[model samples]
Target: MTRAAELPGAASLVLASGVVHLDPAPAVFAAMLDGWAMQQRTRFLKASTIQSRTDLVRRFAAYTNEYPWQWRPVEVEAFIDHLRSGQRPIVVSTARGYQNTLRLFMEYVTDVRYAWPRECEEKFGRAPVQILHEWNTVAHVAEYEGDPRRRPLTYDEVQALFDAADGRVEEIRARRRKGALAAMRDAVLLKTVYAYGLRRREAWGLDLTDLRHNPKARQYGRCGAFYVRWGKSSKGSPPKRRTVLTVPEMDWIVPVLEQWLDEIRPGFGPGRLPALWVTERQSRLSRRSVNEAFEAARDAAGLPEELDLHCLRHSYVTHLIEFDYPERFVQDQVGHEYASTTALYTGVSDEYRNRLLQRSLDRHADRWSVS
Candidate 1:
């Protein structure tokens, strides 16, 4: 009979004959490597924040190179101490993110195989996201007296945003200006966001046929449904996605896109290849560029700096809710499997009750029309 230590994926040397061996390829290193390997199996890191998370892991690994896998909590505490001695609150927060990622990795590596240390609860008592947020708050408070939000663009702010982009857009239309690669890209994406109420990933996923006035797929005005191949928690299964778009929803964005399509898209043959949005030098528009473009447009619109692409989706939902649209319809349009996902918009209890009350009053009221 073979001991579990002799398993294929196990370290080159292990707890052989009940004596722990400190092989050069340690299990601690293997665990980290395993975490990295797992990350490659999924596409969660596309958000770019994972890079920061990974960097923190690298820092932790470098700082505690000789530490054993069982000594993780101790090493983590020591790392926290080291962070406290030199860096500010923000650095401490950054360290916490590293710890959180490490914990998650450990959980993945050990799941039912090894247990997390009990002392972990005492060390950092907050949920992972809360800890990171608290750090941001402390840093913000230190920098400014209060929370200074780069608020979402209001409806009026949206107008101002377009007004600012109008000039560069004109230059693109007239062929008088080959705008900065970044700027042109930014203008087109921002225009799409406001026009389509597109989620960041949706905008990123745009292919040429997604914008067709007469799509070969013929997927227009069908409950405003647009197709999405990949989705969150889809478990790596590609579904026939149908997303919602109203005639009024993104029509304002079409002219700018038409101009881009006419000018930038591939012509008949190799030039006629498919990429709805792309670079002047390349054929594919990267997800990162779409986001960077939104950031650039927010700056060009003279809006606050951190207005993100999700805000476009948020603004869309806000509009639908404000118009008293049914949650079921909204849910269907958004392709949410659960209606609860769409219920976030229905917080106006007073408005709903008052509308019901007003309708009763109107029906009962004596209307005497006097000239």
Candidate 2:
């Protein structure tokens, strides 16, 4: 079938013909956005993804004060330059993402099958063109583009952070505060996040049923691993799935998780709720709450402000490397698609590096000894 024939009704230009409007420019622009959204929906893209892209398209239009058909390469360059000069400038990665979004939107409108170009040409004496070319857009130069300050926490810092989380619960109980249960839950939640090297969504999306037992590691029983259902999704895809097994080094979490599941979690009255982390309202804990919990603990621990909850995952990767785990094993444990990406997360301590050096020197000692 022709691409145009395959499109849904909303994506077709049949309605644009009957529209006798005072300002056809705005009406045509709105129709084009609706058509683009309908096209994305047919591909099974997430609604939020479609909405954000359309919103960005509208913002770009407002910034240039021109419809898509009237837009030029200069407008894109000027807008990006304006973004870079502002007091709160967007990072390179964010700018690249915006440019790519606009590029895709332009491609969609200009494609022969979409008929947006023909419609615009007939109405406005021009057609939309892709303005974001390679020379003007940011290049994907490096595998890792995150802040350098966002490094993995050292073992001492990890311990201090956990101690702070625990102390917060104690302080609440001592003061006869009403949030003791919530505080304790946050403490356990943070530990679980570090233990399994989970992303925020993966940790918050956990349920009692996600807990699994490894036959080989019968000692930890059902707490031996977790099935992550909300692993980060790639473009136009559902969330990836992975099984994050508990390593021997991080097994301290077995008891921590058990205590929450068996004893402390019951205080929340989660009754029939299957969520691993529940609030007083018996609802599954939100990703925002998880972040707030980490922030409070980090502040109490007096750690650097740059260390966010994801730093716990970085710590997990770093500690696993220091504990002598294989690179492939660590990559699998963290659900990383590439060892290089895992390597980016690893900032091994100088002590660990020194130990490795010493081991190598010991192995080659005889060669350098008096011969």
**Each model's lDDT:** 0.53, 0.91
> Least accurate stretch of 10 residues (summed lDDT) in model 2?
8-17
lDDT by residue for model 2 (139-228), tens = 999888888899999989999999999999999989998999999999999999998999999999999999999998999999989999
lDDT of 1 at 269: 23
Scored by lDDT, model 1 comes in at: 0.53
How well does candidate 2 score on lDDT at residue 263?
92
TM-score of every candidate: 0.62, 0.96
